[model samples]
Target: MTCRVLLADDHAVIRAGVRAMIQDIDDFTIVGEAEDGKETVEMARELEPDIILLDISMKKVSGLEALQALNRHSPECKVLILSMHTGPEVVLEALQKGAHGYLLKDAAAFELRLALEAVRRGDRYLSSAIVQPVIEQAVSKVNSNAEHTLTQRQLEILRLITRGESTRSIANGLGLSVKTVEAHRAQIMKRLQIHDVPGLVLYAVREGIISPDD
Candidate 1:
């Protein structure tokens, strides 16, 4: 099946280049383009593409803002953030806000297709050039000393959560009650001081508890 894509960037040249690259791929079709964040959000809502290739900086609205808007308005459409920013904060923020992948602007053309395929399979992707450092930095910032706080059971539950398992599925897999699983999740969140599921997933990735692709 061909995946419908929306290319959103402030630079027309970048959009054109991306379009050329994607046009060569049999499984992807460029359905629309947006020059700024506001337009990106509007087009995303209208087009409802299978994937959105989004830039971080844009006029009128920022990509982060647009990402949040898309999550609220069109949660079914996956978002892959294409940006120049390599800072862990930016990467983590995008992931936490529901981005399916993060690609650096300088990544090779081949990596774009790889990212698309990975995200299309419901897996997360980070550009090869930045993944290691990004994870290291993110984990350090989240408190390197805190890893010991989680018990083995909590770690197992956290991994299941990051893998997108439903609460009941997790309980069944672990042979635990739903209430027991939920209680474990709550303790995991409280122990880590991470409130949202995405935040927990991010922490799991950064701490090497779960692969983004898992």
Candidate 2:
């Protein structure tokens, strides 16, 4: 079966390079091109492409933002993020936002073919260059089991603490005594092996306990 693809990137040169690479693969065709996230989402809805090769950085809206929109509006169209960034946070965020695959921009042309084929076959794909780091992060998180270790109350307090809430305020908000709130905070730090507020915040973000926006 022919696979229809939509290319979304701000740079024409990058788009052209990807277009050239896709041309080498059999049964794959570029159905549309979008220069930004908004256009990408719009084209995706209009074209209903089998796959989208999307860049993370764009002018109007970011690829991550587009992924969220596509998740809600174009659930069937697979999105493969084509980005220069190899950060674990970025890759994880894209996947969490509903991307089917994540490919580094510097990947070999053949890797692109492999990624497309994998996503087309209803499987998730990650660039070989990034797979190790992603796995290591996952392993680290699994070893910690930070999410499962904390009780719901502890998790709630941790979220509030990460948001810069003071013990007095937390106690007031949760209708607990000031001393009780302090004890909970101390326990949270000890359990996570974090010595300070900033460290706790970083751990919270990394463990997916709280988003940066939260």
Candidate 3:
């Protein structure tokens, strides 16, 4: 079956480059392109592509916002985030928001094809450079200490904080107010018994909430 794809990015050069890379794929077809997040959302609904490949840092409406809109309007169309930012916070935010896969902008052509195929098969994919260590560390930590007091949401927020996301960014990404994110930050710190951002980052690494790459 042919997989219809929509490419969304603010840069014409990037969209063109990805089009060049993907145009030869046997079962993948580029059905449309959008230069911004809002256009992405609109094209996604109108075109009904099987997958959307988008950058995270669009100008007016961010890719995260487009992902949310897709979730509401076209849940069947999978979203794959293609970004230059490899921060764990950014990756996790995309996953939590409903991205089927995440790939770095610098990913090799083979890896890009692999990610597209994986998501088309209804499997999640991540850049190999970041996935193995993250999975191993998370599994090891969970096995070593299965019981934790933090709620999953709190842990997620903590991970973002440790990954260097500002509270406002976290709020915008998660569709919460800045004050709500700040409250969650305070609660996370209180629960972890860590008062400072650096301390929280250290704790998150130790607990495997995020990798040490931050």
Candidate 4:
């Protein structure tokens, strides 16, 4: 089956390059091109493409924002993040926000094809260049004694925290007071023995508490 794809990027040249790459594949076809995240979301809802090649730094809505929107509004469509960013934080955030794959812009043309195929098969894909770094970050251990001691509510709070939600936002979304949220956060950190947000994020990913595939 031909996979219909929407290209979303701020750079025309990058879109053009992607178009050229897709044209070489027999089972992939470009359905539309979007210059920004807002347009990408809009077109995604309308076109319902099988996959989207999304850039992370688009103007207005931004690629991450678009991914979140698509996760809610057009969930059936898979998104493959195409970005220059190599940071574990960015890659994890994209996956957590519902990107099917993350492909670095500096990756070889063949890697893009591999990413698309992986996403098409309903598998999460991370660029080979970034896999080791992300794995290394995830190697931090959660406190063994505390691992099974967390309440479900504490796990919920931890999930939000790792997803980059501010305490106030988490409180508002969870319908709790800011002070209550802060207290819960403190408890979570204490139980996990995780001193920092990065550590918390890595722990969350490693423990399967929150995932891109979710």
lDDT of candidates 1 onward, in order: 0.86, 0.84, 0.81, 0.84
Score residue 101 of candidate 4 by CA lDDT. 80
Regions of model 3 farther than 4 Å from truth: 132-214
By lDDT rank, best first, the candidates go 1, 2, 4, 3
- As a whole number from 0 to 100, the lDDT of residue 198 in candidate 1 is 61
- Of 2 and 3, which scores higher on lDDT? 2
Q: Per-residue lDDT for 1-214 in model 3, tens only? A: 9999999999999998899989877799999999899999999989999999989999899999999999999999999999988776677668768887889999988889998997787656778676645444433433344334888878888877755566777899999998988898888777766565545544566676777665
Candidate 3: global Cα-lDDT? 0.81
Models, CA RMSD each: 4.7, 13.6, 11.8, 10.8
Question: Which model is ahead, 1 or 4, in terms of TM-score?
Answer: 1
Candidate 2 lDDT (Cα, 0 to 1): 0.84
Q: Model 1 scores what on Cα lDDT? A: 0.86
Candidate 2: Cα lDDT at 37: 98
Q: What total of clashing residue pairs does each candidate reach?
A: 0, 0, 0, 0
Winner by TM-score: 1
Q: Against the true structure, whose lDDT is highest?
A: 1
The TM-score that candidate 2 achieves is 0.67
Kindly report which residue stretches of model 4 are placed more than 4 angstroms away from their true locations once superposed: 141-214
Clashing pairs in 2: none
Kindly list the per-residue Cα lDDT of model 4 for residues 16-129, writing each as its tens digit: 998999899879999999999999999999999999999999999999999999989999999999999998778877876778788999877788888898788765678878
- Superior by TM-score: candidate 2 or candidate 4: 4
What TM-score number comes out for model 4? Answer: 0.68
